[model samples]
Target: MPPQTREVVVQKNVPATMRDGTTLFSNVYRPAEGGPYPVLLTRLPYGKDIPSYTTFLDPVRADGSGYIVVVQDVRGRFASGGEFEPFASEYEDGHDTVEWAARLPGADGRVGMFGLSYYGKTQWQAAVTKPPSLLSMVPGITWGNHLNGAQMRGGAYELGTIYSWAVTTIAPDILFRRYRDDPQQLGRKLPELVAAIDTLQAGGGYDVLPLTKLPDPDGLTPFVREGFERGVDDGWWEQLNIDGRYGNVSAVTLHIGGWYDIFLGETLRQYAAMKEVAERRGTAPPRLLVGPWTHGNFGSTLGELDFGIGSSGILLNYRGDLADYHLRFFDATLKGREEALADRPPVEVFVMGENRWRGYEEWPPPGAREEVWHLSGGGSLTREAPSGEPDAYDYDPKDPVPTLGGSILMPQIYRAGARDQSPNEERPDVLCYTSRPLEHDYTVLGPVWVRLFAASSAPDTDFVARLVDVHPDGRAIGIADGIIRASARESYPEPGVISPTAPSPIKPGEVYEYRIDLWATGNTFRAGHRIRLEVTSSSFPRWDRNLNTGESGARSSRTEVAHQRIFHDPDHPSSLTLTTVEG
Candidate 1:
């Protein structure tokens, strides 16, 4: 740590020219009396002046800690000059900006990046370019592949996240930029847009028919329409995807993810990829830290449960805050003080239910074994496979299952994270298979998946699986969940991998096996607590409802009621698989 805090100087609208002659602007914060210092850079589409963007690590504080901080507005945003195309310009621009920042006055030729969400993505984009000045990064709550979890997941369009993001966040900026010079048009259109945003936040616009043509009357967000209309196998998503390009990233990384974050799967995938590359090249291994957090909420309490104050990013288990961790990491990687990170563990995860932090050398803790729990008759989950009749449920797209709690991003009305599922269980459309109270503590520390054997009356449909922790008091709290579109089930050949192929719709009333990737979770169900599994057809708005007509939800709004049958007989045993670690 720095012996004392230094006085800071601020420079606003510092310009950095990209290769295409487009100039991006950044706010520079530096120590007043420092001869030289390593630079920490973050480029984001969100305005650099916004306090929320810097909540992860304030530029002024970082400057006081003897680091020059640069917060840049990416091209086509705020102070940058260019047309805004999301995820299109970051690669080359990030490369140019890093070289420019390294040459700034009173700066050593070293640059490290840090940010959460889209800014985090900017870091990955920059690293993949192999910038000479880029050495380290902390990517929090970000995705590696745009198709897998960012834009779409399990072959279903991320309607809730994409729609809410465009309408509530992106549209306003485009509207402002369009009418900034014409006050008359701005005055006429601003109120209407505000009303639309308000209505959407209050859970209104999501139900609009022909999802491709969501109520964007002013045509502010054309990308939203294009995104919806594009098929899952479209070549468009491959341009920005970082799936097979991880080996190109040479920067030492410290990945930060949340169990309930929208991009949790990709975060883990990035870390695993980097770790593998490091091992192959005999380089330093990347570190990881996961907490029981939602997308924007890093607090102790999420939807209903409180994991304890130690879970907060502000003060993690009496260790310093997230900023402190970043400072130490930069000090080690950029400033050549490797000893600064000697005390920190490579992997630190917050296990819920146990409500505590645990450290290990790696993820998926060594010695963990996969355990299978079979679905049995009379709504029971057991270890033994038994003969039983298939359970049936009627799924009507007209009254699809409401988006309950789990890993979801939407407007404020729809909360994410673990919430009580008792009310949803009462609905006939949801099939519940619960295990009896555990005799001992059951600890699950890694990936969670469900293999379903079922048939539907419709040509195509969706299957949703949710793992719940049932308290002795009858509270069913969601842990992890996943969904698989029947037509694209083959696209996901294994966990954490999505290879979109031509859609193959199943024959009506034909039983097929589907694998639902529930992602991963770290939790310990205490003795006397029961485990539950929920099977449903739809999670509306969160994911666009599968119309059961073998048609894209983006183009068609035709509704169909499908009779679903779940098999658990000796020949067709559906089961839930969990990665279990000894307590």
Candidate 2:
């Protein structure tokens, strides 16, 4: 038998108190050996299936990785006694849970937390409180942005993902029409979503959204009704930034986020905020590992089988490669392990197109300078703008540009290869900009931003940019992309209206500068690889439909068609600015 093997022992039904007299349930997982060890706890919205653990990060590994494990249900979840309100009592409940777990029979008094997603949120909550016994955390693929930005991007609420999770997983499928009052009140506003969640406390004891529109409640899942009514970006999202309040948490964190994850921004934010706290407290910030992946599974290939040649050199698991390294970190911090004491660089990111890992001293690197590639005729992108013969494309919001190339969720089988984009350029609505087949590898990192000058025949429109790699053989695989509504040109905060009182049809010759963020990417423009930029006006379903009327955009059930033109000359300087590595 292995000397470090832990005996299966659990103290069930243990209770910890929240400030409001609410109680949280925790089940402790500890070593059979009677020696003291540092405590590791995770408080989550998920049930602590004492029979089957909910977390993927191994606590037994923490035995070899050297720590005690405790998994607990957050307030109002499982056996815990209280009403479950998103982010409302997580901070207070986590503080109590961690402090209590640290005093378990063989606890060393120092505590750490581990988990992902909602579990990860609990860690941030525990750390933010600067709990007396809490020491460190390994939060993976989680977000503090509970609504608006986290679940929905650009006000596009994720009706399918959220509703599916609630109805299918929460409880026995049942009818709960009590929440049908949301749609009218919220109209997709933040406060309304919270009220919707509050509506769950009604007589039937079901969660509901604020003024949520449950057009088909009779057929809809319970989660759907609750999510719709609650789909706003109100202060309910403050939990996403609890790390900002961590002057009390000097724990060394080890941050992890996947390249294809929806929570990439939060992972980055947590690391940055933790680093600030550690600097002032004379400790180092948490180490970070961003892998080329979608969602949680890391340190492994995407699916069941490898794609052969394309997936040559990659770390299948960040945990195996980095855990021992991190253990050395905790050894240095918690046990004075000398080998763990060393200074490392600031950041690491998974470069997508390149399919490799790279490091940097800071994020949004200061070295980020722009290299503009102008759009030329005949689907060409060159340093030189097309003269006399400018390429033209017409955009109709009715049949807007389809979705392609970006950090999104879908099976890998359906994702098109970089050159797959070649066919999309065939459409009249998409403007193609391609550089001649690359003479050598052109790798780019950092956020890809595009600046375009355009005008529409209608008051409102959209500008979508797709970054692609067109292979010499005509394979246009998507890399990354972004979308911006024309009416909200001035700010995301204000989705403005054009000709609000009097509808003025925009003249074709009118010019407007549109800045669109293509998010981030790590790709190499291989020799013979033609770098392409496909510009269109919509990414349907992914982005809410744009009501081309401009003034009543996105809100009104009605939509109008708009004609858009792209200009690329001295008169209209349209260009794409990308961050390229020295390679």
Q: Which candidate leads the pack in lDDT?
A: 1
The TM-score of predicted model 1 comes to 0.98
Task: Residues 179-236, candidate 2: write the lDDT tens digits.
Answer: 3256543243434333433433221112122214432323334434444433233443
Q: What is each predicted model's overall lDDT from 0 to 1?
A: 0.89, 0.60
Report the number of the highest-TM-score candidate: 1
| Total clashing pairs for each candidate | 0, 33
Question: What range of 10 consecutive residues in model 2 has the weakest lDDT sum?
Answer: 494-503
| lDDT per residue as tens, model 1, 1-583 | 7576468999999998899999899999999995699999999988888866665888888887789999999999888899998889989999999999999999999999999999999999888999999999999999978766788888888898998888788788888888889989988998888988998788878887678768784888888989988877888888888888889988999999999888998889899999999999999999999999999788998888999999999888779988899999999999899999898899999999999999989988889899999999999999987458999999998888888768888887888998999988999999999998999999999999998999999999999999999999999999988888899888886788789788889999999999999889999999999999999998888888889999888889888899999999988989999999987
User: Which ranges of candidate 2 are over 4 A from the true structure?
Assistant: 1-5, 50-56, 145-149, 154-249, 276-282, 299-333, 336-338, 341-346, 352-354, 359-369, 385-405, 410-425, 487-510, 550-555
Rate residue 520 of model 1 by lDDT: 94
Write down the TM-score of every candidate.
Answer: 0.98, 0.76
